[model samples]
Target: MAALYTTRSLSAYADLLDHAGILAARPEAAAEATTTISFATDDSREVQPGTLFVCKGAAFKREYLVNALAAGAVAYVSEVDYEIDEELGRHVPCLIVSDIRATLALIADALYDHPSGRVSVCAFTGTKGKTTSVYYLRSMLAEHAKEHGLPAPAFLTGVEYDDGVEQGESLLTTPESFVLERRIAHAAEAGCAHLVMEASSQAMKFKRTLGVEFAVGAFTNFGEDHISPIEHPTLEDYFESKLLLFENCHTAVVNLDTDVAERVLAVAQRAPLVERVLTYSLEREDADVTVQEFERTDGGIRALVRTPRFTRWLLVPSPAAFNLSNALGAITCAEALGMSANAIEFGLASARVPGRMELYPTESGRVLGVVDYAHNGMSLEALLNDLRAAYPDRELAVVFGATGGKGVDRRETMGEAAGKLADRIVITEDDPGPEDPAVICDAIAAAVSAQGHQAWQIVLDRSEAIETAVRETAGQAVIVVTGKGNDPFMLRHGVREPYEPDGDQLKRALAEWDAAN
Candidate 1:
């Protein structure tokens, strides 16, 4: 772990919490107020000497705090005091606050020296296309940075993160406040001029992005997703949470083709922090950026994009027509950042997101196998519809499963879409967290049956499901493997089990077919 570049004394934390109106009680030890904290963390396992431990989450236990204290935590913050036992022989200060999550964000921002203010931070929020849009925009920023002899831009998305210090697969769509602030700090320290990320609805509602102000915030589109007891209780709550991104941004880019575009535009226009609102659309010419025409080319999609600064042809190196909208959102954001047209065109033409509309080479050269992260009902439906249109003559087969314990509505929605649009359906497991995979598969199968598509079967193993779909429809169909994408684990019984990515599995299946035939 990187050493702290800035340190704060115990009294500074107390003062900050007091000013924020969340301080419930101050530490009893007066001398400890002047002690400087070397590090801060919420995980007890990561506690080090002079660490200021933070108590967070409903699952937080007293033993965790005890562990942190044993590991040399000198101070702690929590909603309720976990009074230290005298037998431990340590005098640790405690700063109690009314809201632990908000307090953590405040402290993290201060500890990281408000890194977002030092970098051009761009964020995107929506039910779908956030990951793609972030990557698209990051590519554009990378091109601009390269031309100006600047450091490569940093990015955080659902698939991966490149914070200039570390690059790896991301576990969350939006990380917790402390981690988020730390990455932004790393990006700024590495001399990166721009940082791009995706803002999930849960992040906004829980204040995970509390103190980070975005230079540009883009809204891709809204849909029925992330709706469950543990998530958003209602669709309105989800939509409203996404609107919070615009509240902290200077420029807001919105997709005017969305069903609720008018309302989203209104909210963005009314936000006190938003100085400019830019709209993009595929169907509307009045939008600030519009796609005049788009068509699939040999290995990619070509489009004529019209923006305030330029009206010219743009080519995205992907076959998915849906990416045109994502490209337009990126272009509008790049425009707001004062990037040149050449950078936008060159960056977009080379941008590619892993496991998003990725096509695998088949041995026979006749079968088309694709892997995508279209997990939700709306995204899955759109993907299937696009595939149907792209391969009108070939039979469509889909291998997918709904995640368990969250977004329960996706089972029926995904099944219905596949049943109506696909000729073959293979139900499989997808992150059945603490729930029976068979039960989730059964629910999806029932929904598929309702659509009068009997060409469906359950395969609990996701790898086998992809292989089966590939082998069964070899030489004559388009097979799509969705939901898990290139994610490397499956959540089973609340544990992440090692699993092969959908794209790798598809490639392996194709290779085996080639070996046999």
Candidate 2:
């Protein structure tokens, strides 16, 4: 394999860190400063000759560093020095810093020759609709690029990552600093003009995206989610973490329809790096982009969208009303990039996010099946309410489960939402980790029962749960299966066990229903 970065002397990194005020101490000797580093990584397994290994995360171990040294790592950077015995491991130079996370972002950016500077990077951060908005923008940008004979845009979302050269399933919403910088570099080298990505709160709080300069940054909306000990301890911390995106962006896009719009706008206006602030809305007429009116169609929803440059009717191919807001956010981003109206319209009509509001066909026309990734309370409520409006006469049944070991509050919130909106609820396993599936289901069931709604059942196996929801509610109903979406693996204990995707399982269940009937 070829090197992803150009070789740089050890002193160059030390100088960079010192200027950032995070450098605690430099290399021990002048001769060690001249050592050349050709690669940088946090994963010790990827260490190569002349690699600058980074020690990060709470789970990091001294044995990983020792292995890196054995694999010919020239140097390492960490917040603390692990005194390695000379007899067990070779002695190598190291750099100590006050903040290892920030140091990793800075060093990775330098090693990749600052790829964000070469590509027009746009990032979206919020509690909901981030992945959908990212797909919307990518579609518009890609269509514009294709029309003008330019390369396709690269994107990073919860569903997938496309770096212009390679495309695959994404393991993280926002990748680590080293992997992110390398992918940005690859996109730049592959001639991709734009890179669209999601800026997750955890990623922002940890400084994973510290050194990347965004051409445009957008805030879709904010809500109470990701609250737990292992994640954000409070709602305020989550919101503030998302606001960090504006600190390095040239233009800020705000959604005026959000409840916290004023606070978001105030923070964006106060950001030193933000040169411009643009607002979009589904309610207010004064926003830069606004949805004047909308109505449902058999194919999807069509809206009369008004922008600074154009006022046209746009069609979004989805029955959910909230999707119109997501589309309007995408329109704001496309306009910020100076895209043509034709491109925006075409892209909005053609864009489809995998496992997001995906409607499945049933052999019996009496039943409608929808698959989505709405795991949290806010998102699930929005999806269920929208479905109620779309299919008023049909019964609504939801199949879902909360993840284990994190976001412990979601069980109650999701249960409450489902209890209040859905006619029937089926609780099932969703990445139970080390916890018992029955225990997690019982917690959710208790919340559902608290709502005075007892029409809920627990099914441990996900595939059987989905089939039960379909087979039982066989007529005049909308069967909504959510939580896992297009994810192909179930995390049990600490292992990723292969499992059928939710959409695929739903389809198979529908087929079986048809055959039996």
Q: How does each model score on TM-score?
A: 0.95, 0.97
lDDT of 1 by residue, 174-268 (tens): 99998999889989988999999999999989988988989999999999988999999999999999998987799999999999999999999
**How many clashes does each candidate structure show, in the order listed?**
0, 1
- Per-residue lDDT for 12-103 in model 2, tens only? 88889999999997776674666888888898889989999899978899989888988978888999877664745556788889999999
Worst 10 residues of 1 by lDDT: 1-10
lDDT of each: 0.89, 0.91
Clash pairs, candidate 1, are: none
State model 2's lDDT. Answer: 0.91
> Candidate 2 regions off by >4 Å?
1-3, 83-91, 515-517
Measured by TM-score, the strongest candidate is 2
**Candidate 1 regions with alpha-carbon error over 4 angstroms:** 1-3, 28-33, 85-91, 361-365, 511-517
RMSD of each: 2.0, 1.6
